[model samples]
Target: GNLNERKFLSTLVKENEVIVDMFAGIGYFSLPIAKHSKPKIIYSIELNLESFKFLTENIKINRLDNIIIPINGDSKTEVIKLSKSGVRAQLSFLVLY
Candidate 1:
């Protein structure tokens, strides 16, 4: 299991913001990002279909149906829209675990 990094990251999350999980990996961090943070839009990208499916199911299982958006694609290509949309809006925090 991994430690919760988003608890601190959420301090930087704001309304009208975009977040990109450069490597979403089963939504380990993205799920919490939606639950404990502001209601900003999130874009989670996963390369593995199995993991992406679980990631979507995790969101549903957690009942976080409205906030975290899961995408099954490469982060490098998939995140362009999110980045252009404004994920880099604020680099206020960077918590890694």
Candidate 2:
């Protein structure tokens, strides 16, 4: 069985706070954050095209289009670009699987 970290992470999020998820595979963690935390915005970057596609679809399926912005690229580069573009997040987390 997979360890469910949803409750812990969800509790860490604050309303109107911004979040950056470096490896949001299939929205596994992002979905819970967006849906449960109700953050102002979440920048979810997934490098793998297949995973990115699922991330995008899951956002719609969960009705989190406005909250989660999916970026299909390497998380490192995307995060650099986001910073250059002035997108800031209150919290950032990286997941490796």
Candidate 3:
């Protein structure tokens, strides 16, 4: 069931308990992780409004709005929010292109 998923993410984030999808493409990966792994938090970032819209819709479709945090902007900049909480989100897994 989680065979493929565990392989893909485990490689990059091997030890990263917390993961971040730098480029949340329609929530292809973010939604899955949030749905399966059920991590503490998933920050889905998308610069394009169209992409962001799709991501948001996907999150709703999967009912993961509570688990996945949709950031409608560049992940590089919006990542600051994770720190606003005083360093609670020390992400170890980062998904990029």
Tens-digit lDDT track of model 1 for 6-76: 57666567766667765677777777777777756677788899999999999999988688788888767
Q: Residue 37's C-alpha lDDT in candidate 2?
A: 84
For model 2, how does the per-residue alpha-carbon lDDT over 9-97 read when each residue is reduced to its tens digit? Answer: 88899999989999888987889888778799999989999999999999999899999999999988999999999988889987555
Separate clash counts for every candidate: 0, 0, 0
For model 1, give the 10-residue run with minimal summed lDDT: 88-97
Task: Point to the candidate with the largest lDDT.
Answer: 2
- The lDDT for every candidate, in the order shown, is 0.71, 0.88, 0.69
Question: Which regions of candidate 1 deviate over 4 angstroms?
Answer: 81-97
TM values, all candidates = 0.75, 0.92, 0.72
Model 2 TM-score, 2 decimals: 0.92
Which tens-of-lDDT digit does each residue in 1-97 have in candidate 3?
A: 4568645763443233556677776877777667556476777778889999999999999888887888888777777776675535545345433
Candidate 1 displacement at residue 94 in angstroms: 9.8
Ranking of all predicted structures according to lDDT, beginning with the best and ending with the worst: 2, 1, 3
- In candidate 2 the C-alpha lDDT for residue 63 amounts to 90
Error (Å) of candidate 1 at residue 74 is 0.8
